[model samples]
Target: MKKFAVGIVSAAFILGAGTAVFAAGTNNSDNGFSFEKMLPFMQKMHPDQPSRN
Candidate 1:
């Protein structure tokens, strides 16, 4: 039971971490800094869409 709980906790942590990682590039503005570095990669991922840059 203890091991099962640990596994669930770890899985939740990992999935939550991925959400945080993907959210990092959402604030695409120059107020202080931008996620421009991720833009090209995101564009490549969806090449059919027009680049927003």
Candidate 2:
């Protein structure tokens, strides 16, 4: 029972740390990779198609 409890606590802590790291890594400081900015380029590339869908 004690070992099981310790394992659960460790798993929870690791999961939380992983989630935080993933969230931190996703932030784009340059603002270069945005849908709003890419919309024009995408439209120009596929003029025939209204939307990529």
Candidate 3:
């Protein structure tokens, strides 16, 4: 029982740490990748093809 409890706590701590790191990484807006910047180029390359879905 004690081992199980320790395992659960450790798993939770690791998950929480990973989530915090991910959140911190995503907080930076200037990661150099932007879809809005590339939109015009994409539009020029693929002009309004009807979706074949």
Candidate 4:
């Protein structure tokens, strides 16, 4: 039981750290915008754009 708990904790820690690293490594300014991050500009530029399923 103790080992299982430790493994779960370690896995969570690793996933969190990997996410942070990945976010840090992203360009964040590609194509003059980060579509995933800048919603307002996208709305203005492509108001007619259809929503993704």
Candidate 5:
């Protein structure tokens, strides 16, 4: 019973530490998707459609 408790505690600690590290390492600078960036390609694909700009 003691060993099982220790194992559970250790597993929880490792998981918590890993999650913290992953959260800290994330980048917040991503611009994600931009319709303006895809505008030229979209215009080429369908010239008849009016642009939203």
Candidate 6:
């Protein structure tokens, strides 16, 4: 019984950790960048896109 409880707890922890890692990369702006900083890189990489400014 003790081993079973420990196995359940370990599985929960592993699943929770896996979810947290997956969530970290889902948001593109996770690092927090502003338009001013992002615009130049975007413009250089994608010259075809019309700049809103």
RMSD of each: 6.3, 4.8, 5.5, 6.3, 7.8, 6.9
17-50: candidate 3 lDDT, tens digit per residue: 9999987776555786466666667778888855
Candidates in order, TM-scores: namely 0.48, 0.54, 0.56, 0.57, 0.52, 0.51
- Ordering by lDDT: 6, 2, 4, 1, 5, 3
Candidate 3 runs further than 4 Å off = 32-53
- Model 1 stretches with alpha carbons more than 4 Å out: 29-53
Q: 1-53 in candidate 4: lDDT tens per residue?
A: 99999999999999999999988877657644576768877778899998674
Q: Model 1, residue 11: displacement in angstroms? A: 0.3
Q: Write candidate 5's Cα lDDT for 1-53 as tens digits.
A: 99999999999999999999976665343554455576788899999998766
Weakest 10 consecutive residues, lDDT, candidate 6? 26-35
Native-to-model Cα distance after best TM-score fit, residue 35 in candidate 2, in Å: 7.8
**Tens digit per residue, CA lDDT, model 2, 1-53:** 99999999999999999999977876775754766677899899988986746
**Which residue window of length 10 is worst by lDDT in model 1?**
26-35
Global lDDT scores for all candidate models: 0.80, 0.84, 0.79, 0.82, 0.79, 0.84
Error of 2 at 9 (Å): 0.2
Off by over 4 Å in 6: 29-53
Best by TM-score: 4
Comparing 3 and 6 on lDDT, the stronger one: 6
What's model 2's lDDT at 9? 100
User: Hey, what RMSD does candidate 5 come out at?
Assistant: 7.8
